[model samples]
Each structure stands twice: as structure tokens, then as C-alpha cells.
Target: MSRIPQLVIANGTVVNSFGRRHAHIVVVDGKISQLVDATEPVPDAERTIDATGQLVIPGGVDGHCHVAQVTGRFRTLDDYRTTSTAALWGGTTTIIDFGIPRDARETPLEAVLSKKALAQESRCDVALHGSVVRWDETVPWQLEQLAAEGVRSVKMYTTNRGTTMADGDTILKVMREMVRLDGLTYIHAEHDPIIADCTAQHADDGRIGIEHLHRTRPELAEETSVKETLAMAQYTKAPVYFVHQSTPGAVDLVTEARARGQEAYSETCPHYLTLDDTVYGSAFPEWYACCPPMRSPETVAALKQRLAGGAIHTVASDHSCYDLTQKRERTDDVRAMPHGLPGVETRMPVTFTAMAEAGSSVEDFVEVFAAGPARINALPGKGSVAEGFDADLVLFDPSVQRTVDGGALHMGTDFSPFDGRTLAGWPAVVVSAGRVVLDREGFHDPGAVGRFVSRNGFREHLAATADLSAATL
Candidate 1:
């Protein structure tokens, strides 16, 4: 490893969500010390990287990554080391994971604390979101503990009953508490009744296979739940963020709420913007199995349109590390299969490709890929290439293209949903916290250098990043 106390990235275009400029970034002690003009004399440093002709953007902030996550009878294969290693490979220097309780017996406080302990194995920085499966007398105290631990957000689901769902009463109660705590509420919105009825019909008709996954979870179910959740957020006046929204209508609901001065945000995954329901008819439908499953091609197009128009706040991987064996275990029944895709390693190229296809600019992509997620999640030190920020930066070449091969990825998965797809904008060099991690030669093992980062309260965080929202909007 080429270790240096002071590193200079010279002669590159600094692309931030706010704007772009040609500058030489100086890194010292894991933070960006300065941004010198390209026209000025290059500052002397212990080592220098010639980033000439490269696009220097802030390292990506993947707000929805599941590392070694346990859900029901299944758990993802990758740990923090594997997941964060993959993140650095893909130019994501920071990742926020959910501390969802493993079961009803496991308290949310224990779940979050356990994840924090495990995060010491990460190769990159990490943050967490607390979760609640039900509203109990002790839940509010648990949430207060999470807030004190710097985990300012909590995630709840409107579906996945008996396993991870929270009733409407619980949801409303959590939102009200989040408001009181000055934190954000993270929700997985999907109308369980709509899904259960449709799925039951499908099962009775012998159509509950992987191929029928998308059909069972109708887009209207997602829309209905988004609206319902928005009502609760509005009543509680809590800043809310919806994860993995697959339909344009759901995104539009959040947009409308935001217009009404409600602090609402919609986050869509890369698979939702790229893959469609047609994959269900493919030879390997199990590869596409996920919650709030991929929508029709028309829906995918509309979601991309929503993204291009700035209605979406973040683009997350929703990365689950199940291999082909686990995926094949329940090929005949989507209900038993572990859902989610191995995507943290490919988020950069896939999102860059999708954004280009949406006719959006590079700066716009940075907003969703890095800035928006960091700000909304309260990780202010991440998602930008500027003075005094963490020296987490990536040098990318948008002109460079590669074909994705699932087996070649580093997310501890054996297949990729986007395998064989030619994508552009791969990262050439990655620096995390002033350390040279990935470059032309290869990855430098950083060990468990990633510590748990604390986040600010949502009210203060949003206020600080308002300029970012205004700039992108």
C-alpha cells in the first residue's frame, strides 16, 4: 500500500452536487485539507495521484445496504468486511445499514448495538438505522436509546407480517416519536392486505412461483401504502423517507407531500430503475426475486423519469447477499425465498448508466448517488469532494464501459441481476478516508478501519443541507 500522510489528487474536474470545477484536492489526516485551482501551482505532498482527465466525485453514500442481515429464516452471506470492501470497489466510501431485530425476542436496542459491534470489521465507514417490528410499552425508550447512540433514524415495514411488519398503530406511534426525537422515519411501504389478497389468489391458482412474484405484489399496493404512511407522517409532522419505492405514483405521492411542506423523501433502488417485470419471464426468474419486486418495463421507464425530474431523493442498492443456492431453495414459491439482489459492488456503474439513459447530467447523478443520501441520512462528512470533508473520493471515467459478470463481483454473491449488461462510468481509483484503497493496480486491504459514525438530528441535518436540495431542485 502506498501510505501517505498527505496525498494530492491533481488536475481533475471536481464534481459535487452543487457544481463542478477543475481542482487539485489535498488530503491530510483522512480529511480533505484543501482544494487548489488547477491553474495554480500544485502543492507538494508525500505522494500525488495524477487524476488528469478524470472525473473526481465524492465517494458514493449507499443508504440502504444490508450486511449480514437476518430476516425470518434467512440471513445475508456478506459481513461488514465483505460488504464494505465491495463498497470501496464500487466507489462507495460510506454505507448505512439497518439494525432490524432478528426476531421479536431480540430487542431493537440489542439489534442496533450488535450491529455496531460487528461494524468494527468493516473496511469502510458505517452508520445504522434502528427498526421496530411492533409497538410495545418499551419501544419509545428503545428509540430514545438509539437516538442517543447517534442512530437518528428508525425503519419500519408496512408489510412482511408475522416476521417484520409493524401495525398501523405502531407505525403512527413511531412517527410521532421520531418527530419528538428530531429524527427521520424510514419506512418500507407496501399495503399488506393488497399484497396478501393478490398473493393468496395467485397461490390458489398455482401461480406463486418466482415468475409470478411481481404480479402478486401489485404496484398499486406500494402506492396505497405510501399514501397511508404519508398521512401518518403528516399527522405526526415527522420527516419521513421511503425505501425502495418501485412505482412513479409512490414517488409522486412523496413529491406532493413535499410540496405541501411535509419533509418527505422517496428512495428507489437501481434494480427498480433498470430491471423490469419482464425478468420474471426469463429463464432464471429467481435472480430477480425481491420485495416490492421489479415493476413492468413501462413502470421502470416512469420511475427513471421521476428520477430525472428530481422527484427521487436517493438511489440505493438494497443489497442482499444470498447466493444461487439460497435463491434456488424456493424457486417454486417466492414467499420462502430470501429476497434482495447483490448490487453494492455494481451500484456505481449501473446507476451511472441508468442516469445517462434518463438524459440526466453527471452532477444530477451525484445528487442522488451521494449528496442526497448523505444529507437526508445526516452523514454530513460524506458525499462531497471539498475542503474539510472526509477524503473519500473516486476518480471515474464515464467513457469506460464494462460488461457485468455476477461471479466477478465482490458482494459475496454468485450471480448478478445485471449480468451481461454493458455499463459505463466505472471507477478508476478510490480513496477512503485519505487512504489509497482501489487503484489501477488493485485493492489495498485496509482491515477493519471502518468505525461506526454518528449522525446529527434530522432537523439540524436538513437545515444544513438545504442548499444542496435547492441546488439540485
Candidate 2:
């Protein structure tokens, strides 16, 4: 018989989507059992975490990331074990990663199951977004099977041709099928033709530096794809989520879609909200390269406003880390450089800093970083600190500030995109499933403590229907 976990976390302000309160939390059998007033006596428990003067919130949920992805020539540095360790230390208790299909023979269901198997090495709970690389008679059936098995979202790409890109017809078909299966379609939106043309133009002009990668795939590429994807979502009566949205134009498209009552939501990354295009002008700009690359500071400011106003739904770390050597291998050639940054461990601190600086409250922090992700992706027992919820908590000190160093983080990387940057609100202690996985010292693996979560919730956040096809763009 398993021993009942008894833990008491005291003298902290419990922040959640509903509200905030000074309370003591009780955990029993890996679930939040009670929230008593702070003035009340501490409950008897085997373990106690003193959270005095700390903001005790539900652990963060990173909804989009690529872990141990091996695609043709591109591969992420950190696999499930290292990624989950980094996430725990960073205050994220759950992460939703992609199960990308590598070949035609691999079905989406098989890919998702294989990915879940790999995540068994994780120390934090993990979920998967199923991918469809090819559209055939079997693809729709595969999507239905995946949804039936608790995979609530499917990832599709409108860019990266010759790799994961799906044509317009394929994208439309997937969206319609997701609607039929009661799932969400997550899209990586970028117009392939625009990217190809821009790449050829830059190459012909002999401008192949790392900065040119961003120049080649400009805002128009993302904006155009988002517009088209929204149109399709409207036509098919399917909800769509655009991942790593960077440009104001793309934001505008999402806003318009929402106004037209299309179930369109988007997630922005820390790099997009905090960093700007000037990184491309830095001496070693290759380190800042990523898909849907960072934009100007003005755009960042606008996106921040939207996020603060709840125009944007969630913030996720598109955390795809490649070794520094891999990044520098093609510093002189923009097209060959690996595109990604080590960000899983930095998402919470960076986002917390952004929100606090904007005068947002801890409730807002819990909503965007935790509850919103759980509600959107339908990860049960996550993203909240209420009774019956998973006892995943973070004792975060908002006043504490620290400079980010990649080598110091648990990810498999040599550098950080936010290196040397100081941010407030660091996680002093982290708990996962009622287990103390991270303390001041470091992470402690709890013997395959992470479980594969099969998600099914797909809550609607928009008006019912408005025939957006006939509406103005």
C-alpha cells in the first residue's frame, strides 16, 4: 500500500484564477485537501514548507514546447527527463509537447503514444499535441482515434514546406475533422510562398547573415498565414489556436476572428513579449534566432497590452533548445542556423516580471500562466490550487531578483537567450503531485513521478457563431 502524502504549506498568499487569500494549504494523497485561514493553527503533516512572504500559486503550465524532437536535421537538446527537471525548477508542473510524425508510415496515434512513452522518464506531468504530417484517408481516422484516446489538440503547420507544412486543403480538412471530433487545431502559421520568395531574394542579394533569417520571414509571412487560417476556421466551424504569434498583424487577425465569433485563440512567447528585433543587430545575433522571430519593441509593447487586457489567452514557452555549437555552425549562413532558444526554465520568471511590471496582480499571473492553459487544453487536476486539484504549488518570491544563466539552468544547453538579464519573482520551492521536487538546493527525481495526462476538455471562449466568412476581413 502507498503511504498517504501529508504536507502543510503555511503563511503564504494563495493566488488562483478566482482570487487571492492568505491561507495555509493542506495536501493529502497528492491532492489539495484544504485551504485554511493563515491565522488558523498549522495543520499536522509530515512535511511543512514555510512560504512566508511568498506568493504561493499553482505551478505553471507550459502549453507549447518541443522536447527531444528529432526532425531530419533539427533536434532539440533536452529530452523528457532533462526538460521536466528544468520545468519543475522553473515552476512549471506540466508541459504540453508535440508528438511530431516523422514519416508517412507513422500514424498520429502511434506518434502520440510513442511520445508519451518517451515522457515516462519525466519528473513532471506531461501531455502531447498530436501532429498530422500527411492528409490521407487514414489521417482523419487517426485524428479521431487520437481524440478518443484523450489527445484534445492537433498541431498543423502552414509553413516549413518539405518538412511539416500542410497545404491549404490539408489544413482545412484537419480543422473540419477537429471540429467533428471536438478538438482544437493548433497551427504554426507562416506562409510558405512568402518565406521561399524572401529567402530567394535574400540569397540572390548575398544577404545570408543570421539577421536575414528574420528579414526573410517577415511579419507578412505570419500575418498572411494567420489570416488564411482564421478564414478556414470560420468556414469549417472549427476552433483554431495560433502558436508563437509574433506580429501585430497576426494579433489583429486573431482579434478580428474573435469579434466575428470564431473560436480563435493565440499564445505569445516570452521572447516575443520581452525581447525585440534589436537582438538581430547584436554582435552575435545567431543566439536569438527562432521561428516567428522576435519583433520590434513597439510591437512587444502592444502585445503586452493585449495580454494584460485579456485579448490574448495564454503565454507559453515555445522552448526548443539547441546546443550553442549547433547555433553557431551556420552563423554566416542564416538559412542553415538552427532556430530555437532554451526557454522552458525561464518562462515563469520572465512572465512574472512582465506581469508585475505592468501592474497586474498575482491573480492575473495565475490565470494566464496556469489556469488558462489547463482550461484551454483540458488538463484535469492542473492549473489550480483548489480542493481536489493536483498539489502542484510554487513558493515564488516576487521581490527576489536573479540574473539568468543558461549553464546554471537544468536544460541541456550552453547559453540562455535571456542571459545576464535579471528578473524578479523566482520560484524558491516547487512541488509536484504533493512531492517536493525542487527546493533551494536543486531538483530531486521522484522515481517516474510524472504521469502521462490524457486530456479531453475543450471549453469554448467565444460567442456561438456569426458566419465570419461573410464578415469583413
Please give the lDDT score at residue 251 for candidate 1. Answer: 96
lDDT of 1 by residue, 261-293 (tens): 999999999999999999999999999999999
lDDT of 2 by residue, 300-403 (tens): 88888877777777889999879888988888876777788888899998998998877778888888899888877878778878778899999987889999
- The global Cα lDDT (0 to 1) of model 2 is 0.85
Write out the backbone clash pairs for model 1. Answer: none
Task: Please report the candidate that would top TM-score against the real structure.
Answer: 1
